[model samples]
Target: MSAQEEIDLEFLEVEDLLLRTVPGLAEQWRGATPDEVEQLERIAGRPLPRFYRWFLSRMGQSMGPLAYPSQDFSARRVLDCYARKIVAPNPRFLLIGYESDEMMPLHAFYDLDAPARGDATVTARYARGGDDPIDRFETFHEMLSWSSLFRFQFEQMSQKCEGTLYREDADLLSLLAPVLSSLGFTQPLTTGRYCGLYERADAVMICGGTPRENLENVRTFLLGGSNAGVLRRILGEVAKESSLEVEVNTWTPALR
Candidate 1:
């Protein structure tokens, strides 16, 4: 392990927030075990820096949503990328994850060879930009929490409600909790402030105001995805489960 303080562990919380933005992801998160950590280092031929090691244990299995599936974040993905020549072969450079891009995806890595192994610098190279640095971070935590959070995966359709869900917030939760769960809606998108965001592979839910306690205070409820059917399905469930009446122009009527 490198030179991480107790505060460095807070990156895990940032992981949760970053993941919440994923549109309906199904991955479950639990950092790697001690043995697995040892295995990873063994493959690398050295101990990974402290921050990267802890990051693996905490968010290794699901390091946010990345470019579709080109790069897999499996137990040996670091080596895999290296072997395939996707990233630099320097053993000290450990690939954390890739950032999705329209022009070209960016591959991010931690420089184990850096002097500050405890909190090494993170570097990213464009898919076809050669060895140039498209982005750089002072620490892995900054890379994971702040940088990754802003890099959103693509969504085809998104709609902000004209108003709240139009029912007691509790009724809305009681109405959709099971519905979302059945659809594999795990891994909270974010939980620090505001209502909350929860996602699965097909749908993303954003509740702007606190539900249950006060519906009126709830300012916005956002639902978005690749298709209108996903939005329709959620509304359908709300109607079926409870008599909640919700409607939106979806910017369609606004156009008219």
Candidate 2:
């Protein structure tokens, strides 16, 4: 398949997962028009990579909670950064995004050579010059998928679930819902919440997708409530049996 076609599939998957998790948030999605894309292309000085072009043409303006993601989409930002001499852009690298470290900012780039093969990797470059020697992700799709996950984690902080468990690219809730039911944790007695959300006496799971498969990740949050300590052990058993790469997030600072 073409790179743009592959990106379309990834976008659909992420969009479906986002809708399941936060349907209300999906209303914010606004894709860029063809004219807007053409304008950005002009500013870019050359044609964008296939994956990026697809993204800009179909949801570049916003993606709900992922509206302003780490990957910089506005070609103007790249031009501004280069104009200010903040970072030198490598000719073979497309500057997608940057993150600030203690010493300097790290820039993310897509290698110009690999996009058409339908498997491009994003790599980090030093703020001033030279390669950072780290591959950020095997593909742009993977990077966006993970970015959406982190954004959902931030959004879930304000949610009612005590701790959530997430397994990437797999039907997590299906594998766990039966276990939760067997353990006597039926559906919560709440209204106006996600249909598939489940809860026991201490913790709540905000997994969505219902009868459909849930492929997004979030579970095992250490943000709050007295349930963290108890659920941590339970998750170990769940991990051993389920082989989910269960991870513990450190205490999240209170959102300002």
Across 1-256, the per-residue lDDT of candidate 2 in tens digits comes to: 9755776774565445446544565577666666666654554466766667765655566655565534455445555566686765455676666554546566776665555334356767776656534555546654554444445543344322234566666656556666667655654322111124444555444432211123245443332223445455556665776756665544333223
lDDT of 2: 0.52
Q: Tens digits of per-residue lDDT for model 1 on 112-204? A: 665242566666665334674533544555444433333463233453223356565444544555666776675342332223445667666
Worst window of 10 by summed lDDT in candidate 1: 210-219
Q: What's the lDDT for all of these models? A: 0.53, 0.52
Those runs of model 1 whose alpha carbons end farther than 4 Å from true positions after fitting are 1-27, 33-36, 43-45, 64-74, 83-88, 98-105, 113-117, 126-130, 147-256
Query: Which portions of model 2 show Cα errors greater than 4 Å?
Result: 1-10, 19-49, 61-64, 68-71, 79-91, 98-103, 113-119, 154-226, 242-256
Judging by TM-score against the true structure, name the best candidate: 2
**TM-score of every model?**
0.41, 0.51
Error of 2 at 242 (Å): 6.4
